[model samples]
Target: MKEAENIFLNLINQHKGIIHKISKMYMKDAEEQRDLFQEIVLQLWKAYPTFKGNSKFTTWMYRVCLNTALIYFKKDNRKVDKAPLDENIDIMDVNENEGKEEKLAYLYTAVQELNAIEKALIFLFLENQSHRDIAENLGISEVNARVKLNRTKEKLQFIIKKNGYEF
Candidate 1:
């Protein structure tokens, strides 16, 4: 048991960023993100024992984390006010001048406007997953994945423009 615990801790420490990224994409509020992160960690630990070595650990982790995020529901459905958008912000051009943090913040804000499946597509795309891998992960046909991804990108660009930021 101690050996298993140490192994889990080591694996988690190495791959914890996956959890953080999923939580960030799925949640807007800091407190909610933290809670979701914890829930994902717990789910990962529970599912760890059943994991086989057939797939890469990170791939398996993505499946678990994404599943958790997809099904997670907030207790309250109340909407929170979003911060006012800056009229001059351009996501595509701004990233070149901004620091990584600012670029990431801008990306996340843009992503928050996406629906759940679109969010999943963008998350996988941002990670540079191949269409095959994304389709496998998402359980869709590769052609469908390609089509959806193209459309999702266009939609995201449209959303950014609608929000006064040009991509």
Candidate 2:
């Protein structure tokens, strides 16, 4: 039991960024993000014993993390208010320059406008996951994943432009 616990801790520690990224992608506010992160961790812990080693640990973690994010809204329907545009949260790696930081924040703001599935697809795409991997994670055909990814990117671009961002 102790050894299993240690392995799980190590795995989570190594891939904690997935939790942060998925939580940030799904939840807007800091508090909701924290709550969702904890929820994902708890779900992962509960599902850890059932892990059969058929996939990479990170793959399994993605499944668990994305599942939690997908269902999180079903449990809570309150319209959580988003933070203002000027105060950008450090959800992802930001540039040292103020201009780049604000641009990334604007990108995130555009992302927040996306639907739940669109957000997941974009997040996986940004992670550089192959189309097959994205499809597998998303339980869709690779062609469908490709189509959606392209459409999602166009939609995101439109959203960003509508927000008055040139790039």
TM-score of each: 0.84, 0.85
Residue-by-residue lDDT tens digits, candidate 1, 34-123: 999999999999999978979988888888888778778433442332332223222254337557677677678887877667678878
Per-residue CA lDDT of model 2 for 1-167, tens digit only, reads 99999999999999998898888888789999999999999999999999999998888888889888989965687343332232211223344476787876786777888777878887887787999999999999999888877777777776676778754
Candidate 2, number of clashes: 0
- Model 1 poorest ten-residue lDDT run: 82-91
Candidate with the greatest TM-score versus the true structure: 2
Error of 2 at 19 (Å): 0.7
Regions of model 2 farther than 4 Å from truth: 78-100
Error of 1 at 8 (Å): 1.4
Off by over 4 Å in 1: 73-97
Give Cα distance to truth, residue 127, candidate 1, Å: 1.1
Best by lDDT: 2
lDDT of 2: 0.80
